[model samples]
Target: MKRVLNVPGIAYGGDYNPEQWPEEVWAEDMRLMREAGVTMVSVGIFSWALLEPAEGEYDFSRMDRILALLQENGIAADLATPTAAPPAWFFRAHPEALPVDRDGRRLSYGSRQTFCPSSPAYRRAALRITRALADRYADHPAVAMWHVHNEYGCHNAECYCDTSAAAFRVWLRNRYEDLAALNHAWGTTFWSQWYYDWDEILPPRATGAVPNPTHQLDWRRFCSDELLSLCTAERDVLREAAPSIPATTNFMVMQNFDALDYWRWAPELDVVSNDHYLMSTDPESEIDIALSGDLMRSLAGGPWLLMEHSTGAVNWQPVNRAKRPGELRRNALAHVARGADGIAYFQWRAAKAGAEQWHSAMLPHTGTDSQIWQDVVRLGADLQALSEVRGSTGTAEVAIVWDWNARWALELPSQPNGELRFQDLVRDWYEPLWRAGIAVDFVRPDADLSSYRLVLAPNLYLVDDTGAANLTAFARRGGTLAVGFHSGAVDENCHVRLGGYPGAFREALGVRSDELFPLLPEETVGLTGEVAPDATGTLWSERVRTEGAQVVASYTDGPLTGRPAVTRHTFGEGTTWYLATRPDPATLGSLLDRIRSEAGVAPVRTTPDGIEAVLRRGPDADYLFLIDHTGRGAEVSVSAAATELLTGKPAEDGSVTVPAGGVAVVREPRE
Candidate 1:
C-alpha cells in the first residue's frame, strides 16, 4: 500500500468550500491558509448543484477558477467527485433514486445521502459526475488525490424498497447458488421458513416475530457490500480516467452509525482516511481517539491520514461543548503519534448556512483573532517543524481480533441476554491496555497472528473453522491467548455449535459450559481467588467445567457460586486464559497484569495517569510523542536519550516535563 503522498511535510488544511462565499472572500481564505502553513485543501465536496445545474448540463466555470486559485497559491487540491448529495432537479427527474425506510416509506429529498445504493438512476448520475471531474482534473497541477463520494453509507446503509429487495434476492442467489444450501445455512427447517425460490428472501424488516438470525446477518452483509460496490464503481471511473491520481473516501471509524464492512473496503483504496469525533459524554474520550487512530493505521498497514476532526464542538451532538484550551492541539498530535501522516479538519472556515453550520472549524466565526485560529496556526507551525516524523510507523506486539460478522451476529434477538453489546465487550478489554500506555493493533479474525506475542478475542461469538484453527495454532506455538465471555459459541451462520457452549474451541480453551447464566441489570457477584480476591463480577456469569484448565478465580456468590469464573490452561508451549463472566475494572486489570507479565509484553515507558507516551519508528530515526491529557503538569520518563523536536533541547537523562493539556515530540537516535 502507498504510505505517503509525493509532498514533503505532513498535509495540513482541510475542506475549503470557496463557492460558499463571494469571490472577494476567496483571496482572503487563501491568504489565511498560507499564513497558517496550510499545504492542501479538499474542494467541491458538496458543490454538485453548482457543478451541474441540470441533467446532461456541465458547468466547470466556478470549479476551474477555484482550482486555478489553489495552484496560484501553491496549495494542493484533493478534488472531490461531488456525488454525495445529488441536486434536487436530478431526483425530480428520477424519483426512484430516493431511498426508503424499513416501513416501506419513501424518504423525501432535502437531506444528504438520500439516494439508494442499488438504484440504477443514482449510479448513472454519480458515475457521470465522477467521469467529468476526473477528465477535467486529471492533468491539473493543483490536484493531488481524488476524493471519492463523501462518507459512503453514512446515512443510507440499507433501503427496504422494491429495488433493494430485488437486489438482495440476487445477492443471496449468487452466494448460495441453490435453495438447498440456503435452507441448510439459514436453518429454515425449524420455523418452516424454507425458500423454494430466490425471490422469497427479503431484507430483514420489522415483522411480527424477529426475522431469522441468519437472514438478518446476511442482510447486513449484503447492505455493506452494496455500498462498497458503489464506491468501487466510482473508483473504477477515476482509475480509468486519472490513473496517476490516488482515490480515497473518508471513513467514519469506530462510530455506531454505519455498518459498512471496512475490512473489505480497505483493500480497494490507495490510502485509508478516517473522520473521528470525540464523545463528550465519555470521560475516557482520549482512549477512544487512540483506538480509532490505531484501527485506521492497522487497516492501511502503515501511516494514514486524519481526514476530518472537529476543532472544538460538533453541530450534530445533543450538547456541542467547546474544547478546552490546548485540547485541539493535543488531539491532533494524538493522531499523529498513532501513525497519521496528515491532520485535517472538517472545514477550513465556519459555514454561514448549512446543515453543519454550528460545527467548529479551523477559522471559527470569530475569525483570525480568536484563540481557535491562533491554536490552528501554532499547530501548523508545529507540524512543519515535525515534518521529519512523516512515513513512520508504530510497532505493536498485541493484537485484538475485531470481526464485523461477529458483531452483527451478537446483535441478533433471543440471545442469552438482550443487554449484551459487542462494542461494550471490546471496550472493556481495550481500556486496560490503553490506560497502561500499551500499543495495540486491531486485526480481523482470519488475519495471521504469528507476529504478536499476545492476542485478545473478546466477544468473538461467531467463529468459523479457519478462525478456530488459527487461534489453536497460535496457542500451540507459544503465543498467549485470552478469550472473553460468550465467545466461540456459534458458527459463521449464527447456528449453535451443537455439543456445548463455546464448542468450537472448548478443547483449546480447556473449558465447557452447559448453560449461560445471565445476571439481571443490577445484580452482582463476588469473585475470590488468587487473581482478584475482592473484585466483583457483573452483567454475566456462566457455569463452567474445566477439562484440563486450572481454576484461577471462582465465584463466591450467586447461583454458580464456587464455580470457575476464570480459568487458565497450558497448551503445548503457551497458555490460554478464559473468563466466563464480565469482571469489574480491578479484576480485569489484575488479569491483564498477569498476562502481560507472562507474555513479556511491557509498555514503552510508564507515565502518570493522564500522560501518554507513543513511539513511531522510521528508517533513519524514531519519534516519541508525549501528550498530557490532564489539566496538570506531568513528568514522564523517556525510554532513551533524545532531542525534543519542538524545542531543540536534549533530554540526556531520559526525562521530560509537559505542561497541562500540552504535547511534546521527541526524536530519538535510531539504534
Candidate 2:
C-alpha cells in the first residue's frame, strides 16, 4: 500500500518551532496558521535540548503544550524525534561521540548533527530519545506522521575515528565475509595493502597517496548504510510505540549535496521526503527544482513531499538574493506539477537568532504586510485551490538514470578530466528535455525501465554487471537509450574495464574507444555531419569507432577531428545513441529532442520557453499543470475541455492561458 501524508488534501505548511518564541505568541501563530490555511507543521525537529536536557532525563512539558496547541488549532503535527541535535549535557558525557574529520581532528560541538553516526553512545542516546517521543506521543490526536532524525547525513557522513574504524571493519566483514574476498574487491595487490586479518583494515582514513578507489567506494557505501541503520532503528522504535503512523526522514536530494545514496534509503522510508533549497547562483534553479521533484517522485514511485524549501533567499549562500515577484508560487507549483502531494518550507517563522537567521521563512522578519508573507498566504490559498490534484500522480515516458554510486566514483581522484562534474553531465542532458517541455522521471540504473520509452544515462562512471545488463536489456526491448560520455568505464568495484573506454556499454551502444582525449580548459570542439549543424562540445572528446552503427556526427575540429562524435545503432528493435563529448545545451537539447521523437515519446503539452506542462492522472480526472517560470503569460492548448482548478474557471474551449509566472491547473474529467 502507498504510504501517504496524513493531511486531508495538499499538506501546506512548514517547520514550526514555538519554542523559539514566547508562549504568549503561540496564539497569534495559530491564528496566522489558520489564516494561511496551513494544515500541517513539523514540530520539535531540533528540540532535544528542551525535551531531554540530560541523559535518560525526560521533560515533555514543552512538547505536550505544543501538541495541545496544534490540536486546538486544528493543525496536524508531523512529530519529529529530535535526534538530529543531541543535547549538550548528553554530548558532554560522551565526548567521543563527536565526529572526527579525515585529518584526524576531533570536531567540537557547535553546530547541529555533531554526533558521529558510528558512535555507540550516539546511537543509544538517539534511540532513547526517539523511544521517549514515540511513547509519549503514541496516541496524540494532533500527531499525523513520524519524522525520524532530520536529514541523516548533512554534517557528518564519513568519520575516521577509532570507533568508526572498528565499525567499518565490521561492515566489511559482513560484506565480504572473508579477507580474501575483500582483497580481490579492494585490489589490495596494487598497493601491497593486502590484509590477512580484519583488524588490519581501516576506514580509508587520511592516506598519503590517492586512497584505493574501491576502498573509498566501500567506505562511502558503509557510511550511507550506517546512517540508514540508525534511521531504521529509530523508525522501528516509533513503529513499536505507534504502528499507525508513517515515518520518514527528509532527504537532501538536490545537486551539490551528495553524501548518502538516496536510492537505497528510499525503500526503507515509509514515505519519501526531500529537502530542496535553490542556490541563488544557479541561473537555471527552476529546472533544478523540477529535476529534484522528479527524483523525489521517482523514489516514491508516486507522490512525495517537498519537505523543505525557502520562501525566498537562503542565508547559506555567499550572496542571498530574494526571489523575484512570482518565483515562490512557481517553485511550489513546480513540485506539485512533478507529483508532490504536499508542499512545505524549512521554517514557518523567521528566526530572531541562528546561523540561518537570514533564511527567509513563511512569516519573515518583515511581518504580515510583507511580500513574502503575502506570497505565503496566496500560496496557501493556491494549494488549497488545487486540492483536487492530491491522490494524482505523474508517469513519464522518459527517465534519466540517477546513480549515487556512479556519482561518488566519478568525483574520486584520478579521473580522465578533473574539471568535469557528474552533476553537470546529468543537467546537460536533462536541460534539453526540460527546455523542450517534456516530462521526466529519475530511475536507478537497475530499476524497471519498461514504463519509460526513453532512458537518458548521463555518464554512469561506475555501474555493476546487473545494472549494465538491465540498461542493455532496456534498449534491446525498443527503448531509446542515450548514453553520455565517460559512462560504463568502470565496474562497481572501481576496476577499469580493460578492453575499451566505455566498458559495459561498448556492445550495446555499438561503439568502442581506444583512449579518452580530455579537452583543456576553455577548449571547444565543433561537431558537424549528421548530429547538429551548430553542435559544439566542451570539456571532453574521445577517439571513437563504430561497429554496426551509423555515425550520427563527427568531430569537425578537435584532437579527434573527423572521428565519430556521436553514433546511432539499432539493437533488438530499438535504437541506441552514444555521445562522446558534452554537447552545448542547445545542441544537446536538439539531439535529445530527436531521440524523444524516435522513442515516440510526446510531450504532455507543449509550451513556450520557461513554461513547463505536466499531467497527473487520478481515479476520476487527468490534471494538467502548466507552470510558468517566465514573468510573462502564455496561452497553452489542451487536448480536451477542462476546468482550471486554481481559477475555478472552465477551459471549455480546450485552451487556457497561464498567468505570468504562476500556475494553471486544469482538470479534465475521465469519461
Clashing pairs in 2: none
Scored by lDDT, the top model is 2
Model 2 per-residue lDDT at 405: 96
Model 2 alpha-carbon miss at residue 605, Å: 0.7
How well does candidate 2 match the true structure in TM-score terms? 0.98
lDDT of 2 by residue, 175-210 (tens): 999999999998999979999889888887787899
Which parts of model 1 are misplaced by more than 4 Å?
1-4, 639-641
**Across residues 1-671, which tens digit of lDDT does each residue of candidate 1 receive?**
34235556898989999888899999999899999999998899999999999987999999999999999999999888888999999889989989999888899889899999999999999999989888888899998888888988889988988899999988988998889999999999977899888887778877888789999999999999999998999988998987777888999877674487789999999878889999778777888888888889989888888989999999987898999888899999999999988899989999989898999999999999999999999999999988999989988999988888998899789988898888788889888888888889999888989889999987899989999889878988999999998998888988889878667879888899998899999888999897645788888899999999999999999899999999999987889999888999888987987887799899866888878888898897888898987778687776456888877778878877787789888887876
Model 2 spans with C-alpha error above 4 angstroms: 1-3
Residue 218, model 1: Cα distance from true site in angstroms: 0.6
Alpha-carbon RMSD to native, per candidate: 1.3, 1.2
Query: Candidate 1: what lDDT?
Result: 0.88
Worst 10 residues of 1 by lDDT: 1-10
